[model samples]
Target: MPVRQLADAVERVAPRDRRVWEGRLPVAGAGGIAVKVSPVRARQLWMVVGMWDRAVRSERLRGRRIRSAAALFGRSVLEVFWDLAQAGELRALEPGPGRERALPTATLRIVRDCLGIMAGLVKPADGAVRLPSVEQPEPKATVRAEVLGEVYRGLVDLAGAGPLERDGTALSYEDRTRLLAMVCVVLDAAPRSGELAALRLGDLTAGERAVGLRRRQQKAPPNRAEEIAALAEVRPSSVRAVLWGRRHQVSEAVYQRIAAARAELEPLPEVEWYALRPGTQVALRRWLAVRERLVEPIQGGRSALWVTLVPTKAGPPGVTLRPQGLTQAFARGMTALNWVMAGQYGWEPMPTRMEQLRRAITVSPVPAEVVGK
Candidate 1:
């Protein structure tokens, strides 16, 4: 839908907002009707916010063994310990009231590894761990799906916030590519990032109409890589799914808009900020925003409360941004944040390497937003 059209619709409904209905989105859609987001959706939205932060922290460190070998592996002390604490928090959230802990196979890998890292005295040369056995299955997969939706919301918010880079600097083409590569590391190392990352351009670009994606580990035993069953198709300028048990398709134009938002993301100094170090909270602080889709930060599973969009075949999503301009200011935020919080929380000051990753394992309730709390 065009911005003007969307805006007009929102305006028409604005006056009718008096404790609207709360429920899940309908499985099927009519040609042109819009519906109020359900209560289940609102909860899911907040859960995603919380999950996004958790995934980011799990990537570069382990829980128990964080300190044993971090200075050696090149990650900072701060990053390592935070991962460990992050893991503990998730494990505790395994079964809770109003909280969830299930995640995809890839997310399972991240959470478990942090525990392994925290357990060992000497660094285990093989960096791996078995997934924790869970009594229930619902939380595991639901959280991951939630994150993909959040990624979409985040992209849209970022686009609207405009470019977020530093000034007087032009990234060499290679530098720009490298920068995006780094920014995605936070996303890639995240819970479902592995599944999303597993997407070979071939996998993403595979089908002629809608691309096909398979839900990998859901029904499979350990070591069984499930066949691709999830399907995504590329329409004229949009992507949709006519096969996921029901109708699911966004406009050709919306897809283009999302793709553009992602392209514009790389130019921001946030690309550099994320690229420079590996901290989930740091990234969240840098990019988390109050937007249409946000319910609460790390609320449960999905990173964004709404959708997840990416680049496609015909034309890369085109965007214009200026993030490089904020480099120093971001660095200062990093430093001040470290100064006030780390030591106060028992973390070592200004950790400088990657292996210093195994510290705390916390599922500390990530508030919905900077303002939401």
Candidate 2:
């Protein structure tokens, strides 16, 4: 039946519920006329209206101090229903003469949400009502361990090599810089991706003892401080030191020569840096060098630590790297590392690089001087 005729039928039989279905048709016919709604659509609409009416009446019957149950239902249950519909889980039943259709996914979701909402609203003495939700299955422990191991190995490689050449293609100066900065930040501060993305050049204050990171926490309290020790054993040609050394210059001939030389040399075996060690300092220095050269530091306005080197016709020179972009970059680096590792050594079911590193660290004895102290 046409929507107008259905509206009329609903008005005659359930005038109070007419407004519930008003202007809610998903589609309209030609000339902006109300289209004929499926029998399933009509049924679902009426069922919701009926449910709403019952909820309202129940609130009055209970004489609760709070607002009407219908109001609560609209706020919670109705919203959940719309969410399910938008997710494409709600579909109209097939038009048939006499066929019992299974309950739609939307209907089930609505019912589930409504029951949970109503359970809280209704008195416990009313009945033995229980709301059961299936827990989502977690990823396998081995799989999770493997992923973390890959990420750990990738980070170590990045720290050592500064953005590596993948498939005979070297990353742009800007990309290499960004990856270097990300790895250094992660190693030194262990900040969330958002926090890392939020960092600015000004936020990094170099004191006599350490390089301090002063940034507002995205998920926690404001004004957290993280430090990279000044005396920390970093590579002399560290990314941090390089960045600091060539802060003003657009291009550094020395750094480029060094980078080129490193690229030509045999790749170093990936090594883990413990605490405030040489590896961390080297990564930090290298990252700083690249960031200084590539990123145009604009004070106050879009002064993000990581910015885009290339600008489009629509935008400015320094575009801040968003958290999402940072995450994608990290994932890409991990994938590249994994691919390289796979090529070098076939899947032979050996302990992860991380596990091996841990074993090595465990077996190594402390220095006599440090132990005595």
lDDT of each: 0.30, 0.43
In terms of lDDT, the best-performing candidate is: 2
The Cα error of candidate 1 at residue 360, in Å, is 27
How well does each candidate superpose onto the true structure, as a TM-score? 0.18, 0.39
RMSD in angstroms, all models? 26.5, 22.8
Write down the RMSD of candidate 1 (Cα, Å).
26.5
Residues 61-82 of candidate 1: C-alpha lDDT, one tens digit per residue: 3242432222322335334433
Candidate 1: list runs displaced more than 4 Å.
1-154, 165-191, 205-209, 218-373
TM-score of 1: 0.18
Judged by TM-score, which candidate is best? 2
* Each model's backbone clash number: 85, 12
